[model samples]
Target: MPLARTSDLLAAAVADRRGLPAFNVITLEHAEAIAAGAETADTPVILQISQNAVGFHGGRLLPLARACAEVAAAARVAVSLHLDHVEDADLLRAAPGAGFSSAMFDASHLPHDENVKATAEAAAWAHRHGLYLEAELGRVGGKDGEAPLSAHAPGARTDPAEAAGYVADTGVDALAVAVGSSHAMTTRTAALDHGLIGRLAAAVPVPLVLHGSSGVPDAELRGAVAAGMVKINIGTALNLAFTPAVRAHLAENPAVTDPRKYLDPARTAMAQTVAHLARVVAGGGQG
Candidate 1:
């Protein structure tokens, strides 16, 4: 099948009260591994490329985007490409053309009114291009680089009423809310406020998205879906699986100068992790 749209995947998940796993892809291997995992689990998944990832690719996006689209197209299960946490207006505007079916135009760092205005403008552009737009209402708790996380104050949770109004005002297809999970967390110990999640789901018109979901435990993630989170974005967990595999392979075989020898094992590890996460997101046990 061709690449699926983010809206379509989320819509199905919402109807079934299931969570769609959205994995952040940093390399071609990541994209292939994620797609392989989704195929293994027989579940639909989202392949996300973050703005930070674009920077890592030398300020280029299309090359990786096209690769992800190819992966999605070849996958047995439905797969979509998403541009995640895109703050720059130009980058947001360019996403759909670069093969992203959806984009998150992050203006949550701006003042409320300014955020609304900026998100509305970006949403309009995305809609005009028939793309799904996701907007954040509050700081989703994590800085991109060495930037101080304190710059955005931790624990800034989203207000349900304000979230509804923001979604209404911006015409966004989804909302990424701050519900206690912090970005780039290496430990799966983040305690999400389930009550807040249910309230946000009731109040917000669109589907709710959970960013920094890699911090939340697997059981809690499943509970989050039952509480009405339709889209769960994960990053660090895949990295956690991938990096160790590469390290182990290199340590065991010092003579292995071939990149594929090490990278293949890393990709396999990532694929297994993705498959388990996919099952978890689908409300299945870690199979």
Candidate 2:
């Protein structure tokens, strides 16, 4: 299959009343692992490259984006390349040309009106280029104990009415709403408000996206999807699987210093994690 558009993936998931698991890709191995996992599960998945990941590669994005596109093209199941959490308008502008099928233009850190204006501009540009655009409405908890950007301090749940307004204002293809998940959480204990998810899904015109999904437990993830989340974004869980595999491989074979030796196992571990998450997103968790 060719690289599927992110809009198509989300649309399919919405039609099926299931969630699409979107894995964050940090390296070539990560992209490969995500593709392999989607193939193994016989399901479509989204390959997301974050701004942080781009920075980690020293601002080079095209190479990795092309690699992800190529991987998607060659995969048996559909795969889509998405630029995630992009704050720079320039980067967002460049994404469609650089082979990204979709982007999350994050202006959630800005004031509400500014976020709306910026996201609206991004949505216009994305639409012009035939790319899908996702925008965060309320702040899904950021890392490092940063307060969420809502009237409520800690438990900043997205208001259903506000979500509808935001979507109407910004015209985003998808809306990431803050329910209860926090980003970069290593523990899978985040309690999501499924009612809020349902409300947002009812009120918002676009598909509801669940960011910081790595912090959500498998059962809770299933519930979120059942409640109407179409796109589920995961990052930390892959890293959790990948880093430990590399460490274990290195510890076991101290004499071997080959990057491929350790990385291969790490990739496999992450692939397994992705497959499991994909299955969960596909409503297999209910079984």
Candidate 3:
């Protein structure tokens, strides 16, 4: 199958009032596992390649992006390629040729005026190249060695009205809002502001995205979808599953020398996580 359109997947999820799970890919194993899991669950998924992942891959996007595209093409389920958390204009420009159906131009780290200016230009370019664009407004916590935001922090949460204005101003296809969850949290104890999500859903014209969703619990994830979070970005949870599997495999067989020996179990573990999360996002959490 060819790559599924991100716009179509998002539109379908929106119509069903469900959340779409997007997993970040750091390696070929990650892409393979995500595709396998999505196929196993028979759910549509977005395979995201973040800027950091590109940096890890010697600053080349096409090698990994094309690999993911091939993985998506071979998958039985609907799979879309996405450029995640992209701050580089050159990278965003390369997205179309790299087989990305959508891209998130992250300017949230910049001041509001600068964010708007940068994101608007990116959005326009994305539109010209026929890519669906997702943008962040407020700062989601725990990115780039930053401290996690307490629930009471004023800047931790996105203002509904401000988000709506930002969406309108930037002409983005979707809005990633900071509700309560923080990025890279290993524990699943992050409490989401469901009420704020609902308000943002109502206020913003575009689909609402929840970044740092790996920290959100199962029930909270379902609640977020119900409260109108359309896109759920998950990264750490896959690593949580992958890394432990690799360690456990090595512990059981310390003599193993081949990377494939451990990576196989690691991939399988991550696949199971993906399948379970797919069910959860599809409103069938218990299975």
Position 285, candidate 2: lDDT:
50
User: Best to worst by lDDT, what's the order?
Assistant: 3, 1, 2
User: Which pairs clash in model 3?
Assistant: none
Error of 2 at 10 (Å): 1.0
Show model 1 residue runs off by greater than 4 Å: 139-153
Highest lDDT: which candidate? 3
lDDT score for residue 21 of model 3? 90
Model 2 off-target regions past 4 Å? 139-154, 285-287
Per-residue accuracy of model 1 over 3-87 as CA lDDT, tens digit each: 9999999999988889999999999999999999998888999999999999999989899999999989999999999999898
Clashing pairs in 1: none
lDDT, model 3, position 139: 46
C-alpha RMSD values across all candidates: 3.8, 3.3, 3.7
- Residues 190-256, candidate 3: write the lDDT tens digits: 8898999999999998998888888889999999999999989899999999999999999999999
- List TM-scores for all candidates, in order: 0.94, 0.94, 0.94
Which 10 consecutive residues of model 1 have the lowest summed lDDT?
Answer: 145-154
Superposition error at 272 for model 2 (Å): 0.5
